[model samples]
Target: MLKTTVLNTAHRALGARMVDFGGWEMPLHYGSQIEEHHAVRRDCGMFDVSHMCAVEALGPDVKTFLLRLIANDIGKLKTPGKALYSTLLNEAGGVVDDLIVYYLSDTHYRLVINAGSTDKDLAWMAERLCEWRLDVCLIPLRTGPTAVAMIAVQGPHAKARVWEVLPEVRPATEKPGPFFAVEVGPLCIATTGYTGEEGFELTVPAAQAEDIWNALLAAGVKPCGLGARDTLRLEAGMNLYGQDMDESVSPLDAGLAWTVDLASERDFVGKAALLEKGRQRQFLGLKLLTQGVLRAHQKVVTAQGEGDITSGSFSPTLGCSIAFARLPLGVAIGDRVKVEIRGKRLDAEVTRPLFVRHGKALI
Candidate 1:
């Protein structure tokens, strides 16, 4: 049986077309996927991201445990409620999982990881904790009786809509800049989002999820599903776990070298391997120049060498097909490439990975 989120019934009531996403029964779209996409790009939309797991690390050794656990430097998280994006790597310097770590204090921190990676991530974390024999404790916040549900409100006016829905949180949430979160009563309002838009990710108790969803609905926030979320993230040039990268792919070759801190003397799990192997390929964005929708695993032929499309979709914001491809090194922007679609080769232009951001086309 597939797992369902606490807001499953609410999604069904709203006439959502459900599909199997990983192991979870999630809504693909409520009515129109494109409209939901536009709602986020042009106005405001909300997504039920309750399926994502939240884990809390507590104890005095939390900072020490994190410093050697992930690739990014956690020392930068001096201010409470500031969030950092990092990847957990195996001994081979490949990506184990990409996650967001929020700094609450020296002794406590929170992480929100991809839903599909929850089980393995927890097990790996547990195994590592045992190996290190640290005093810190790993607590899963998305399970058991104390589970929480997360709702992502995105777009230009997303923050304002969240403030209108929960007025009491405004005082706490208004001041934080992007990538910062604040704890207000039962809410953890974070100025963070996947869509390339200003927004807030509201984490609340699972019991209050339905009420919050209804309130957001009543406040005119369009209910988006996984389809729109995927398109939005892809258009924003964000890497999707399992699709854009996995255990075999390094963060450096996946266009995530910035997320990995190699400069500092602080040794992490994959630092040595990353330094030894170095970046092999260039990760870039492809804009289709001809008629045809781009999809993953398509063959891309460039002057440098052959490459593979990692993630591809029709970009509603740009009104064209866009994709992320792992191309051979030395491929430059404005270079023309051929993408094998079916039997015919389609023309595409290589550009920076970002296609659309903040409701505007960057390509």
Candidate 2:
């Protein structure tokens, strides 16, 4: 039983190549994947991210519930609409999932979690709320009136084009800060994106999904698919949840240590385990020097030891192969290494995990 988003029919009508992505039927590409990737880099492109779960927790105890459930501190959100990225960890210090939480008010917080981890994430939070006797109740966006279409409009021109299509969303986003969200009526627009470009992720009702999609299309925002989304995120140095990190992996090796809040003694889940786990491996960026397609699970041979590539792709913007690898902590930037691609060793170099941001190359 595969799930489908509100844009399922629209994607098929546009001649999109569809595939199973995390149990959801999703578009891999509409036509030329490289063309779609460039469209997002140069102009604006939209992706139907309705498969992602938008779970909202509300109550007087909501803030306290989150403070104990996630690795990051929700107390950091001093202002309304402020969003925080956190790793939801288990009792053993392994990552359960990485999610973005938005503070709407003192009693209301919205969590946009990965589609694959929704069930486990809900169960975990539910048990904790019961145990702590917190009054928080989790509400998934897919149910009832809260059901909405999650669309991502990305690129340097993304925001301007969004205003052209849905002008009503502008006044709410006037504060103009990164990692912040604004709710106008039933619409929730957040100034956050998986791609390293300026964009706003829109959450609108399921009934109005096609209308909004068409409006954006008419406003010159091209339609993109998961294929283009992958290439764009790779160039931008964003992590794909299941591949980059999982329940068996820790944030220390997943290039997500910054999201882990260890400054306070608030006693979040997995804090003790994380303190005991002295990072053995590190997450670093890889640029293939030789001509070849870098793929995941490929063995990387560094001078220190052998490691593996977690996520890899041919970057459309950079016109080269880039990947994220979990390597020995001693692996420094500018260190030469070899990647085993199809039994043939290829030349590569190690650098920082971030490759590009704001449509510009950092490496």
Candidate 1 has its poorest 10 consecutive residues by lDDT at: 137-146
TM-score of each: 0.99, 0.98
Clashing pairs in 1: none
lDDT (tens digit, per residue) of candidate 1 on 204-259: 99999999999999999999999999999999989999999999999999999999
lDDT for each residue of candidate 2 in 199-253, tens digit (9 for 90 to 100): 9999999999999998898898989999999988888888888899998898988
Q: What is the lDDT of residue 175 in candidate 1?
A: 80
Question: How many angstroms is residue 66 displaced in model 2 relative to the true structure, after the best TM-score fit?
Answer: 0.4
- Predict model 2's lDDT versus the native: 0.90
At residue 18, candidate 1 shows an lDDT of: 97
Q: In candidate 1, residue 155 scores what lDDT?
A: 94
